[model samples]
Target: MKESLYKRIARELAQQISTGTYPPGSLFPTEMELCEIWQVSRHTMREALRELTEQGLISRRKGAGTRVCEPPTSGVNHPLSHLEDLLLLAKNNLRVIKKIDEIVADIELSQLIDCPPGSRWLHIASIREDAQNPDAPICWTDSYASTDYARLRTFIRDDPHSLISDLIETHYGIKSHEVHQTITAVGVPKKIAKILNVEPDSPGMRIVRRYRDRDGKVFETTISIHPAGRYTCSIVLKSQNSGE
Candidate 1:
């Protein structure tokens, strides 16, 4: 497996743009200049530049030379560094428990949580509010955990700041080895809309997280719904070569 010369050039240029070497609105080298510098033909240089243009990294015109554009960043506010950060989000907020019930997952619930239809679970429903601004709710969350830890219900009600997964680990001595998450754009349901004080079918973000134990068995599933502009998720990525 070998890398093509044009693609390699495109990657190098992209790195420069990302690293602010060629900042936004700055002029980029001309095709002839790049061809001469890289010792490549006009076609190869054109292809490389075209790749960057298509990625919205740069713009070019006949008379106006190519210029870098502002790099796009995901609308993020809080940067989650590790599992503790994830738990901190729940611990820092105030969760007002709406209801707790024992149930068997039906067909729809099974698909949503990625669990068997006949699985028994303890469902805890709550609304998270900012500690300082309790008047404005943040999101609605539904957490389903294995009924084996039903004793956790009392503790959950008493401790509104602790996450169920954390509680499970504390009481049952079972730790989460990994967590799988999925985020989707959805409309706020009618029931949730009223509670959140938003319009029905309004824009919302649906986030589902599955917590697994060391045995790779899913022990808990949580679904959270946040109104548009209410929450922003962020993550930092690094390259292996950059020893930081």
Candidate 2:
């Protein structure tokens, strides 16, 4: 298989933007310049720009041309990176409420939390609502915590707005040494769709996160399913001295 010329151009340009070759708040090369450099038609250049824009890399204005976007404060970059950027992008315009319960873990969940099958655990379910329309649901999240850390129950219950890692530090004196996140696309389950106000088979993004403490203890695991149009993620890599 071969990459199309326009896609190749788009990928190369995206890389440049990600690598700081095109720093934030800086103008990108003009479309005519890109056309000349890539030796492509005007439409091809425009298509490449469109691809970059879709990835949240740059913004274009009719009179001002295209400028590289600043990494979003609420996205994968800033101090609150783990918390999704709910303000800038429409996809994340939702509020979440947490519900706590106790449950016995099944095999799949047991493996995720490093517990034996059928282990008792505290489960927290979070429902997300569209900010614009309170009636619209956008995401559903479920988190499992080891029963040994019963002290965390109060922390989780009290701080709905705090990041889980932050809560762990505040209450348990356990600081997260590393965080692992995985994302996949799946069809919404009927139960979740009913809450999200979408068809049962609607597409969605599923994010699974595993939190580890300083001593390598797995403290929490969370799974979040977001409606197709209601969430997105971005990663920004900067050179050590780039000061981004």
Task: Give the alpha-carbon lDDT of every model.
Answer: 0.80, 0.69
Any idea what lDDT model 2 has?
Answer: 0.69
TM-score of each: 0.67, 0.59
What lDDT is reached at residue 239 by model 1? 75
TM-score of model 1 (CA atoms): 0.67
Any runs in candidate 1 off by more than 4 Å, and if so which? 1-76, 241-244
Model 1 agreement with the true structure over 91-132: per-residue lDDT tens digits: 557789999999999999999888989989999999988654
**In candidate 1, what residue range of length 10 has the lowest lDDT sum?**
72-81
Error of 2 at 162 (Å): 1.1
Mind sharing the TM-score for model 2?
0.59
Clashing pairs in 1: none
Expressed as tens digits, the lDDT of each residue in 126-192 for candidate 2 is 7755544566565688877776667666765565555555666666676766667788899998977
